[model samples]
Target: MTVFDDLVGQAQATAVLSRAAAAGAEAVAGGRGAGMTHAWLFTGPPGSGREEAARAFAAALLCPDGGCGHCDQCHQVMIGSHPDLEAVRPQGLSYSVKQTRELILRAAGAPTQGRWRVILFEDADRATESAANALLKAIEEPPPRTVWLLCSPSPDDLMITIRSRCRVVTLATPSTEAVAHVLATRDSVPHDMARFAARASQGHISRARRLALDEGVRRRREAVLAIPPSLTGVGECVSAAERLVKTAEEEAGVATAALNETETSELRKIYGEGSSGKGLNRGLVRGGAGALKELEDRQKSRATRIKRDSLDEALLELVAYYRDVLAMQFGASVELANDDHRFELDRLAQSSTPEETLRRIDTIMRCRERLEANVNPQIAVEAMMLGLRRP
Candidate 1:
């Protein structure tokens, strides 16, 4: 086993990172090195595993035996528990300046145990302008033993000045075969189910795993897929829109509920309610209430973002269904993402013309744009469902 095992289908990137890790080890050993840099930018489309690659590189850099995957160092890095590695994943709409400044302040310190102190930021493109500026200072004058790993959807998503300071790693979307192989091998999913999930997810590794392992996820996806073909009239379109929004809300709640409770409990302990603190100090209680309020606000915003993302996933699933229909209509030999639903795809293809399929695809895309722009989700989705009706 190797550190790059989990980074499926990214051979070029794995090789680049492996060489860089070796150079980092040599650098610490007082030898000449190659392909070692203080900062790295990993760019890829969603589900391409940019953050996964960064974590593997961190493990390799920290492991004494050059990233022996079974070592404690590698395990710690993989689970994000290593003392020398800090991973920042923004929970809300953006990474605020305050949080970035705090991270920068912590990053100025030297490594505690590992050869290098690694700061990994997933979705670095979500950093606010002021936060990005704060991060820029750290990259410009990083500590000798500090490394920064930034992940984004594309190089262009980041400020040019910041991108210029970092070595770039690009990852391609993995093929359906690669995704299915990983699902079957790593998650122990049945071969046929793994193949179905892989095709449905369109190379999204996490979604593929979830779709393979979770019946509810598959059911939700089936519902989304059914909506396109069921939009026979105004009432059905409106009902489908409501169902989609409600399902998204439920999904978002499920995602955040446990996390919210854990955070609240931690805060309570910090504020003197639990054994971690002395019997409630009045002044501390007042401060704690303010902190709790701020946390709740962040949680609300996070919940909203989660709902939007869930809705978008369903929208994309509908889009893929039509894409497959169009592919069938044109006799395209390319792999279909919804191959598990070939019967439905055939029915849709036979029922609708290519122009209708293309128009419906456009409607779904527009709904996505509308959601991103903060338009009412129900309104946009209702219109999209109506537009998807057979003409």
Candidate 2:
């Protein structure tokens, strides 16, 4: 097997990266930077395996065999334990300039054991403006043996200076058939459920896996889909909005609760929480308050980001449902993404004009934009539900 094998439906990108990796092996051995770009930018839509692609590419470059997929070198890269590979994933909403400078300092060092140094940075788009500028400097003049792999949704998400300094590898959303095949073959999901989740996921591979296997995810989706039919009056619309926002919050809380507690506990222990010995760094113990406050701020930002992401997923599901209703109204021959809701789709299609469905879609899109602009979640969702209420 090769490092690129698990990258489903990205034949073109796999081929490009494979050739680059082959060239990279030669460059590393010959002590020449020929036939390899020092920096690469992986751009794709959500669930397009941007981070996975970066990780695989790092393995290929680090492995002596250009990614045999089973060697110790490849395994280390996968687990983020390779001495020469620096894999960074930003947990907070933004990566600060201070963090960027530190990362660049680490990247500037020579390789320890591996032939070349590699940095795989996920969510490169989350770098703050000042941080991006700092990153640009490092990418512009990276060490001869250093390689940078940055993943983002699009080239536009990064600065032009940084974009121009990197070779671009764009990945496309995998087809439903391809996603379903992977779900069945890799995740061992049953055929019928795999197809259903694949269709509903709208090309998001991770989401398809969750929908196919996670009962909580499935129930939450059902609740979101149940919103449209229940908006009979203003009060119902208000309640629907409340329910939608609350669901996002609940999911975020579940995701962050244990993580937040673990981090807090670790910080306390480090700061002499249960100390009894000559921890004569009482000054350091007193300094824990400031560090704790910083950690709290970061956790809050992370929670907010997760909550917004959860709400965005719900909004996208609503968009898909209305899109199916619009398709039914037009008598389109194409298959519906929400085919399981055929009864409701048909009823809504007959009761509403295509124009009305389009209006509702526009309203949902507006709500998504408002949320991105940092409008209060309750207010934005309420406005959307009110607009979605049928006349």
Candidate 3:
């Protein structure tokens, strides 16, 4: 399949980009029109293929055949080896001014391979104010043969000045059917498993893929989904809270340990263990310390975010369960998100009122807000569990 095929449920975005690329090519060939713009902003939710779309467009722009999937140009862009294409992905919490200046300097130069130079800012929302200002200046009056692509959750996530200067391409979340099709066709997963992952992920492609591939993920989800009916007392509420905290910690530990090891190895290589013999190499020591500090800081931030995201996923799962409960309460026969949990949900429907289920949904939403507001994830989850357990 083509790169465009990977962008599920984004037909409008694909059409807009295809047309733009075609028009740009035509302009170049006919020697007319206000040549291609130097900047583009791709806005979409996480796992919505915003960066993938940008890369595809970049490939098309560089390829003579308009992104023939098998061509050298397309292959190079896909693997990130294209000389004219540079992608800036933040390693730490945010892109620094130094990194933005480096990109700006590169953008000021002529293309090394293709007719135009391309710079992609993946997750531009992570850029610091100084970095954003530096990038803004570059976008304000880019070099003649330069093109910038910025990816973010939405146009509002970027500075108004920066947003006003670029063309915007928006992508919506894919449907469950689209996600299921992708899982079955691309990953060769079983149809039933693919459907369950698609429905449970709530339109997140990467999460759906993970849920399909990892048995542990599926098991964890099952455990979370089972919590609603079992939370019958204060002790059960505390136990649920403890379990969620432990799960988040385990996931965060796995993520951070891998990153920490990589960073530590890189730092050791840079320092070179007394090779200089210059009495401790204070500069190298300081640099290594700073890098470790930055790595740890970013890891802390990421851990917090991961916990909240994990909790949010659990909340969504709970919502789906309750929604089914509500439907059953109202004597509706609609399809359920957690059809596998039908027995448990049916029990809930019989035990609780529809109004109580709605209130539980509201509590889940407030828990999400609290997590977003930087409240302790464990505390927010604990309170949510307590509220869910109340009669």
TM-score-wise, the better of 1 and 2 is 2
lDDT of residue 198 for candidate 2? 90
lDDT tens string, model 3, 1-391?
4557668899999888877777667765765535357799999877688998999989888888777778998899999999999988775546778878988987787887647788988989878899999999999988876889999999998999999999999999898899999999999999999999988787789989999999999999889987987788888988898898788788877877887778667766676654664533664566866776766776777766666667777777787788888998998977677778888888889988888999998888898888777787778888999989873
Cα error, residue 46 of model 3, in Å, equals 3.9
Candidate 2: what lDDT? 0.91
C-alpha lDDT of residue 242 in model 2: 94
Worst 10 residues of 3 by lDDT: 274-283
lDDT measured at residue 234 in model 1 versus the true structure, 0 to 100 = 91
Number of backbone collisions per candidate: 0, 0, 0
TM-score of each: 0.94, 0.95, 0.86
Best by TM-score: 2
Work out candidate 2's RMSD over C-alphas. 2.0
Ranking by lDDT: 2, 1, 3
Which is the better candidate, 1 or 3, if ranked by lDDT?
Answer: 1
Error of 3 at 94 (Å): 4.4
State the displacement of the C-alpha of residue 179, model 3, in Å, after optimal TM-score superposition. Answer: 2.3
* lDDT to native, each model: 0.90, 0.91, 0.83
- The candidate maximizing lDDT is 2
Could you tell me the TM-score of candidate 2? 0.95
